[model samples]
Target: MIRAITGLLSGIVFGFGLALSGMMNPARVRGFLDLFGQWDPTLAFVMGGAILAMALAWLFQAQTDKPACASQYHLPDTKHIDGRLIGGAALFGIGWGLGGLCPGPGIASLATQFVPALIFVASMLLGMTFFRLWNRG
Candidate 1:
């Protein structure tokens, strides 16, 4: 129960931050991605802030054996670059370039009931479903 509560609270804070940072807007995301044209650097600052916060959190986490709200720290074990990683990253970049919305911001934008966001989120779900099925086969 505590884990779930903390997860929910963290998600709420993250979504609020995304909304406040204008990342929930597809246009703003596309603008950030636009390099040769009118590129917006606001998202870079947001990303920088997030990186700094995560670095600080990691520094704190290094001092602990386990998380306060969990039995153990669940971290990624893979360290090698492989085909699956490259393919997934390529897919993510393509989707982001096409729709200007990644998973986090895409879900956050759902609060607005925007049709494009809805379509993007639905497509993302479908892609995840297909990946799971393919992996299980």
Candidate 2:
């Protein structure tokens, strides 16, 4: 119950932050990507703020034995990057540039831009499904 509630609350806060930061707008993200053109630095500021928050979280985590709502920290074990990582990153960048929406903002923008958000989410899910099927060994 605690874990579920924590997840819900965290998601709410994250979604609210995304909406507040103008990240829900595709134009804002695309503008940020336009470095040589009419570039916008708003996304950079938002990303910087997020990174700072995570850094503080990491500092707090280091002082704690375990998570407040969980038994232990579930950290990623993968340290070495391979072809899969590079390919996935390239695909993600392509999708982000073409659609101007990644998973978080794509989902968060559903309330504002229902159709576009739905399309993006559907396509994302489809891609995930394809990847899963392709890697099923």
Candidate 3:
């Protein structure tokens, strides 16, 4: 229960930070995406900060004897960047460029009840469902 509470609190904090920092705003994201034309680099700092935070968290986790949470991270480490992965990435880029909402912010942005965020979250869920069904079959 404590772990679940902590996770929820942490997620709320992160989402709030994203919103306060303007990272959750589609306009800011669009500005960042318009690189070749009137490029904005504010997103670079956000990305750098996320990378640093992840690195620090990983470093601490590596040295700790106990798990970060009462859970484990079971993930696949695929070395191959195959055509499917490339195609997915390209599609993701296009979606991000067009809608300015990735998974994280798209989910978080639901609090504001914005149309773009709603559409992004809806499509993201639909895509995930399709992928799961496709993979299962």
Candidate 4:
């Protein structure tokens, strides 16, 4: 129950931040992504802030007796960055550039009356389902 409540609160806060940051606006995100072309680099500040936040979290965790949660931290050990990872990243890049939406802000933007956002969410779920099926086969 505690974890669920915490997760809900965290998601709300994240969504609020997205809305506040203009990340929910596809145009803003597309502009941010188009640094190579028009050279809009507003997203860099957002990313830098996130990196700083993660660093602070890591510093806190290192000082603490244990992880902030009741569970142990589980980091991935998969060292191989093979074809699958590359292919997936390329697909994600294309989707993000074309659709102007990544998962978090994409889902958070569903509250707004944007047909493209809705379509993005639906297609994202479909893609996830397709990958699950493809991997299971």
Of candidates 3 and 2, the better by TM-score: 2
Q: Would you estimate the TM-scores of all the predictions?
A: 0.94, 0.96, 0.85, 0.87
Better of 2 and 4 by lDDT: 2
lDDT of 2 by residue, 9-128 (tens): 999999999999999999998999899999999999998998999999999999999999988999989799999899989989988988999999999989889999999999999989
Q: All models: lDDT? A: 0.90, 0.94, 0.85, 0.83
Model 3 per-residue lDDT at 63:
81
**By TM-score: ranked, best first:** 2, 1, 4, 3
Best by lDDT: 2
TM-score of predicted model 1?
0.94
Model 1, residue pairs in steric clash = none
Candidates 1 and 4: which is better by lDDT? 1
User: How do the residues 1-137 of candidate 1 rate in per-residue lDDT, one tens digit apiece?
Assistant: 99899999999999999999998887887898899999999889999999999999999899999999988999988799999899989989888877889999999888885787899889999989999999996
User: Higher TM-score: candidate 1 or 2?
Assistant: 2
TM-score: which candidate is best? 2
Error of 3 at 137 (Å): 3.0
Worst 10 residues of 3 by lDDT: 66-75
Expressed as tens digits, the lDDT of each residue in 2-75 for candidate 4 is: 87888899999999988887777777768977767775576777788889999998898778776655677665
| TM-score of candidate 3 to 2 decimals | 0.85
